[model samples]
Target: MSDPIAARPAQDRAGIRVICNDHSGRNSREAEAIDLAMKVLGPQAELCHVKGSDITETARAAVRDGYATVVAAGGDGTIMAVASALNGTDCTLGMLPLGTFNFFARGYDIPEDPEGAARVIAAGHAQTIDLGAVNGRLFLNNASIGVYPAILKERETVYRRWGRRRIAAHWSVLKTFWRFRRPLKVEIEVEGQRRRFRTPLVFAARSAFQLEHFGLQGADCIRDGGFSVFVTPDVGRLGLLSDALRLAVKQMRLGEDFELICADRLVIHTKRKRQLVACDGEKFLMDGPLEFTMVRDAFRIFTPPPGDEAAA
Candidate 1:
């Protein structure tokens, strides 16, 4: 609607120290905007550019070098990388999103434009955000195994190279959704209840599109000591049709195609050798029976001019 207030008064800010991942693939528009942001911050900012295979190392170095704010300037993958690196540390996170979907970015109103996001960072308000983990890895968003992970793997490869060409991303999704190899049969236990589901796919979300983008079911309520979860049945034509409808209308209530739940922890098992799984948008191979938990106020992150700083 109306243009959001871009920045807050400088006197209230907690000061600035930024660490950046310049390696992320981004459109030129976003790049130029972020460059301007860096220039605007001037002496208030100290940026660390990533070197080969050293995203974590450089980020940790920034923290060790006394950076009070750590910014993840790339996709969800980059965000997760930085998030995990800074997890449990005092440095607050700031995101300069440059990913295709930017699921978390959109959910939190983190602007896609670097300058817009930077203005928020300059405001210097910080809040603690929850994170979910599978096995021992940390993820800022949802996680899934089975067909969902497979589709995500394909989506990731194309997205990394091409960015968000909606038609192309959809086409790639279509090519894989129909012919996904080996249906995913999963057994999951949540809050001490167990269920066996034999479906073409499975998704365990810690806050995801409730119905394709009507929005996350508990968007406003998450990080308040509880987390929302969802599971998709399968990926056949009917399933595809249902997903399509969800995309079209965003009717996000619990319906036949979806199962919504809330809990502190969950466990899942699969019969696949390397059950493909995604946490946030990062995908990796994992073995059966995993636990996912919500860590309340896990880490502090910077938000916009509304000022995420705790009220004194």
Candidate 2:
């Protein structure tokens, strides 16, 4: 197998490149975060304000421009887009976590606030981490299909109407459930074994910290070099709502509410030719038969050192 780590760029020439999307998740504060990052990283660092669709290409351009470190300064979606391009490439990844959830950045012990996160990047402590991929696209937190993607669609609408806030995100979930009607019939294959499931959602999780934070099980499986797959039983709308409530309260039961499948790789097939998939809080339509896999030590990320008081 080819080595996952790419050769680092020459230190003397390569510099830091920070990418931000003001329109991502909660748009208003992204500008402030970008300004703070630039101030912290100094004038030599390059700042690129990119649109959502152009994030990956911009990160690629940063790599081609010989940047040593490319920082994503928005939410999980921005981080995922930048990582999709920089993963297995010469540039190191950094984060500013300027979003509502900021799961990907928090998972790496990066600070949620912009200034603290920027200092972590300035410290330049690099580490290699595993990344999950579905259909050849990388995701830092988790990916899901079925009701979750529908919820993301609703969330976007809600963000536009109510502005971006945690309450708005939760409200969107409630709205999606009230209108939820369909369950997916999928064939999931893992480790040469195949099984069928009728479920409202199939969630594949890559970040153990996210699962643990939500009071969910399967983190250990993720730490063991595999991703955890959660399939919600084909519960009717009311039952699904009940599960959502349980999850919100961190009282969700494992076997009773959802089935958990732990594997290094898996393939999911649906009857539909195309399905909406949500990855790291971004939704998109993808062709069927989604394959999910994990690449261990694949991406180099900038993180704070152990017990770093300044970053904390």
Candidate 3:
């Protein structure tokens, strides 16, 4: 595809700012590409590095500084933080995928390479997308409780010891599953319909691509509005392990292994006063009765036009 920014005048690309996470994958390499891209774009195109904790405030400051576009250069967590800050704003959010999965970026067809994604940002095509929220905390991907959050907690420890690789992530999952063998008893309300469940996990997905990836149907249910909630029925450890294996191989069937529900507003209640919830790979200890809602066209994002592959 032709370069979008190349067709536009140089002055039009000047009002862009890039906020990069220093801890993202291969930070040095990402920084080099981003810096080079900024120089190519124009003198007014600014780049700044920020710690993960400061991404939200830094993005808000960029908006306050009158930047027309703010690019998030990191993983899903970094992107979500910046998105939370830019929610309901006119400023466009640009993605420079530098994470392990880059689910949100890939779903939107954003390039994985820093330089290629940078070119798309320079091209400046923007689209409106939905946002998911859990108890006021916004997320770009999905949120979950039970086994999902437990796996993330274990993944951090394994990541620290073995480095962040796919093998280490899988190892973490095995260890978490072996350690946490009990199912959680909970009540869930979806679109005013209530059901109680004894399950190993419950996942609420906003990204249709992610839902399709797991082989769990119902992407169309959430395409218009609402979330696709996945609940794993009461199963033994061996059964749970079998389900995990199916998910790994992309062979999971919803009715046999889990249940899928579609709802605009969901309320989850657990015995504990506070629970650890995982949202887009980040874990948070939030108070119960967890409330989830979907907001349509909450923000604008710069993405590659449909069917346009990243430049090699």
Candidate 4:
């Protein structure tokens, strides 16, 4: 397929600022990575360390200061935080993927190596892309409620004990499923149609590359400018566990594994006033009647050149 994203004009190198998260999952050598990044980015670019909660404000400040590019040097969560401020603005978003999964960065062909990624930023090639939003918050990949959020909550505990590894993430899923009970009862509204579902998880996906990477369906729908909402059947705990295993091995099937719903906008309501919603690996306690929507051409991001095989 031909690349749908077109590159924008080159940005001013002197106006670049990188906000880095030292606590990212794969950033064990944060000091070394930062030093390498600065050298590759040149003396013109600025780099600073900032906590997660302060990323948005810092990015906004950079924009106000006439920065041409604001790079997020961390995981998807950190990227999303900076995106919240840059979305709809002229400043392009750059990334150094220092996360465990690095799904968002990988999807755009952004390098995981800090110095290599810094070189991409220096090149100043960018493309406009869509982003998913839930109740006004932006997410680069996905957002979910139910079992997925529960898994994230458990994953933190496991990470604390075992450090942040892919194994620990997988382990948390199994542990959460073993103790999981009570499937959520949710009312969903899509395109003026209302439906009810009782399920263990409701996942809303915005990244076609992520779904394709996982061997799941709905990548085309997402590329066509919509979100794919996957609702797991109210299969009992044992059945859910079986499906989880299938997912781990990339052996999951449609219909039996999940019922897919595609829409540009949707609303979900549950009994609880507030629920734990996981967005790109970060958890948020949000109010009910959750709204999920896609914002097309939401922001510009630094990416590999068009027709680059890695981006494809």
Q: Tell me, by TM-score, which candidate is best.
A: 2
Q: lDDT per prediction?
A: 0.65, 0.86, 0.82, 0.84
RMSD to the hidden true structure, all candidates = 7.2, 2.2, 5.5, 4.7
Better of 3 and 4 by TM-score: 4
Model 2 spans with C-alpha error above 4 angstroms: 1-13, 25-30
lDDT of 2 by residue, 237-299 (tens): 889888889989999898999999999899999999998999999987899889998877777
Per-residue lDDT tens digits for candidate 3, residues 1-312, read 122222433234338778888877743566677766676557767888899999998988877666778889888888998988778766789888888778899888777888788778877778998788999888988999999899998988987787666678787877777777878889998767789999989899888887777666878877867788899987777777777788888888878888888888899999989988999999999999999987777778988876666543
For candidate 1, list the clashing residue pairs, or say none: none
User: Model 1: per-residue lDDT, tens digit, 253-309?
Assistant: 465766766666878777665666777766777866787776655678877646442
Residue pairs in candidate 2 whose N, alpha carbon or C atoms collide under 3 angstroms: none
TM-score of 1: 0.81
Error of 4 at 43 (Å): 0.9
Error at 270, model 4, angstroms = 1.3
Off by over 4 Å in 3: 1-14, 26-28, 307-312
Error of 3 at 169 (Å): 1.9
Rank ordering of all candidates by lDDT, starting from the highest = 2, 4, 3, 1
Ranking of all predicted structures according to TM-score, beginning with the best and ending with the worst: 2, 4, 3, 1
Candidate whose lDDT is highest: 2
Worst 10 residues of 1 by lDDT: 1-10
TM-score of each: 0.81, 0.94, 0.90, 0.92
Query: How far is 119's C-alpha from truth in model 4 (Å)?
Result: 1.8
